[model samples]
Target chain A: MTTQQLHEQILQKKSFLCVGLDPDLNKIPQHLLETEDPIFEFNKTIIDATHDLTVGYKPNTAFFEAYGIKGWVSLQKTISYINEKFPEIFTIADAKRGDIGNTSSMYAKAFFEDLNFDSVTVAPYMGKDSVEPFLAFENKHTIMLALTSNEGAFDFQTLETNGKELYKQVLETSKTWKNSHNLMYVVGATKAEYFTEIRKIVPDSFLLVPGIGAQGGSLSEVCKYGMNDKVGLLVNSARAIIYASNGTDFAEKAREEALKVQQEMKEIINSKF
Target chain B: MTTQQLHEQILQKKSFLCVGLDPDLNKIPQHLLETEDPIFEFNKTIIDATHDLTVGYKPNTAFFEAYGIKGWVSLQKTISYINEKFPEIFTIADAKRGDIGNTSSMYAKAFFEDLNFDSVTVAPYMGKDSVEPFLAFENKHTIMLALTSNEGAFDFQTLETNGKELYKQVLETSKTWKNSHNLMYVVGATKAEYFTEIRKIVPDSFLLVPGIGAQGGSLSEVCKYGMNDKVGLLVNSARAIIYASNGTDFAEKAREEALKVQQEMKEIINSKF
Candidate 1:
């Protein structure tokens, strides 16, 4: 999807919520286990119940990978479900994949062409060659890891690099690369203050914000600092939305949880812009 | 496989050669594509031909993922073939994956358990929790990205952070993690001198050195600075060895190329130790 298309979806939904479709067998509803594909079933229902309320859906690849070949099939099916049904909904293959130039081109092909995701998250450790391949895919987004919402983010991201924080330098240096206009960034919502500094570097670029709800960052605080005139933020809530309940009402409960976030997002959007 | 087992394999093979199995459909011989599964067929022949010459087999995951589900199945078959036929070879899934704590656990399960790779490469941008899960698996290894061989490595890795390079900080901070013992690192062979500094932080750790032939890193220089008492390096050469020839004698040619590297390694080992 184009940035303009995503922006229109945000306006139409009155929210920038991206429900993370991270399915785990240990956490899904018991009844679904009887089905041939429990993971896809759970995701199908959740997407059905809440597709309109959110602008994006992120299926983290690791969760699917854990189950092996069948898990990969489930991932493919879930993505196909989204693209076929909710074509307007932005999709992210939350693969956290990056490698050398040639290897990275394969990853871009897997997510953008083969799986047909609108975007794929990439790690920044490999630098421009790893990132530029993903960017080379027309209109497909490459969300590079910046200040993540984990304790590990402090390990290298926050450390000062060349008179600035490493993450800040990542934010600055990436803009000069080829096809960097296709870049979006993954900035965790855990630290509201980081958003203030982050927005200063790349004010126009959309930031895919995870770590709200389950990770406990205020949506209002994230918006107060991170939101731009274009409403440049995708606040992701995974566990608190998807696994809201393990009962048969799992998807409905997920919708209810997502509804609460979407409603809050509606309020935040109306007030800000 | 345990680190001790890897050390033993290096001793027995008299080579720290890691043959990178990165089979591209466009690059493989025309005859292989006529088979039921070309990628696996190519990998099977290569493994059969070069099993004794190398101690490690690093299958970069991006190549397989590009082919979609069939590719995933092919990957499963290739790894299974290796485990059954060449049980002594240390397998490295060159999938540079890392995420938040819970998500990372799934990746750990995917590579270490589901696929049964001996080690998997991880991007360290997410910090401690992202890496710890991979280390949690018994006898499995997590090869963290340090200074990489690609041009992109200079983007953020070399940027000085807190008085040290970001990659250096990744090396230093990671040493304090829960399973530091299970950790190895990816130090590109391109800059052999970097090994002098990397060894200071991770003197005992095994370094998975890539960029030997295809990316142009000298093996002899890599060994001079990177080798330790146990020969502390799994120097990888993928395209130069595997794509040595696209003829009917492809695997034999691959074996010949591998033999050359193995011979060089044999000399390096004899001279160093």
Candidate 2:
């Protein structure tokens, strides 16, 4: 999935919300615990409920991975379900993977060819060889970590480097890498103030914005500076949506929360253009 | 595993070699392709051949991830095989995973709890919340990407931040994070010159050094500067070992390469103390 297709879907749905599937086993309903695969069952219902309201589904790999093989199976089923049922919805393997040259190539194959995610979140610390492999895959996007939304982000990303912030330098230097046209960036929603500056460096690239819902980042504040002409933003909400309820109504409540975000997104999209 | 355990193992083996399991499908012996699971078969043989010569096994997750479910299954088998047969050998899920606080906690659970890897490579872009989650796990270590081995690493890692290099600042700041006692760092062997400087800040921390062999980094130079009193270095050799041969003798040739490294490491270990 190219960014262009993502833009068209946003236009069609009038929403830019990306529901994050981060299923914590402990937080899941007791009813699901009775099932053969609680994670899969929970995810199936959530996808069933919220597929229409959102343009994307971002499954943070860690949540599924915690359960070991069972969690991984659930993750595969969730992506396969999204692909088969909601082909138009963009899918992200929120696996922040990055490594050296040869290793990065294999990672590209894993996420792009094997798991079949539209994009995968990657760390930029290893630089081009690590990142370019993900970008090399045709139509696949690489969401590089730019300005993250955590307190530690202030430690290094925002530290002044050569009279400029390091994240800003990451944004600027990444533009020169091979196949960078396929690049998108991960800019935390909590760092909304940095968006104005980030936008100047990556004027046209898509930004995967997390930290909006459970992380307490304001939707309006994120949109105020992060959105571009093509609605270049995928605001992800995990706990606030997926774990909205601990009962059979979990999926429906998830949809309700997703719907609320989609409604806000509709307004934001309308106001933008 | 803690750096202390790793250090003890290095001393006992008289080798600091961390043989990287980055089995590229195209590079594996053609005979293994006849098997139902070529990747696992190849990895098992390599592990069996080199287990005694090496102190640690570093599996780059991308290699297994590329093959899809089968690849991940192979990874599980490979790691399980090591754990059951050679429990003393340190295992690293060379997965540079870093994300939000909650998301990172789940990742920690994935590698440490589910998969049972001794440690994992983590990106430090998100700061404390992203990295601290991994460190929080008992007996599990987080190998934070500090100075990487890539052309573009110079672009950001070397950038001066308030008079200190960005990588230097990362090392200094990481010390203050919660549960930082378990934190290790990734210092590319290619950047051997910086090791003397890096050791100044992170004296006791273990450094996972890649960029040997195929990447043209000198093992002698790396040991000269990177080695601490505890042999605080895990010098990794991936392509040079795994792809040592494309014939059925691949395992034997891998053993030979691993032995050479072990011999060098033995000499280094003897000379250092």
Tens digit per residue, CA lDDT, model 1, A19-118 = 9989999999989999999999999999999998999999999999999999999999999999998899999999999999999999999999999999
TM-score for predicted model 1 compared with the true structure: 0.99
* Pairs clashing within candidate 2: none
Candidate 2 lDDT tens digits, B76-190: 9999999999999999998888887878888888899878999999988878888888988878888998998877688778888889888999999999988999899999888
| iRMSD (1 decimal) for each model | 0.7, 1.2
For model 2, residues A70-139, the per-residue Cα lDDT tens digits are 7878889889999999989999988888877778888888788878889988888878887888888889
User: Candidate 2: lDDT over CA atoms?
Assistant: 0.87
lDDT of 1 by residue, B182-234 (tens): 99999998899999999989999999999999899998788888888888899
On the 0 to 100 scale, the lDDT of residue A155 in model 1 is 83
C-alpha lDDT values of all predictions: 0.92, 0.87
**Each prediction's DockQ?**
0.92, 0.79
Q: Which ten residues in a row have the lowest lDDT in candidate 1 chain B?
A: B159-168
Tell me how candidate 1 scores on lDDT. Answer: 0.92
| Candidate 2 chain A lowest-lDDT run of ten | A98-107
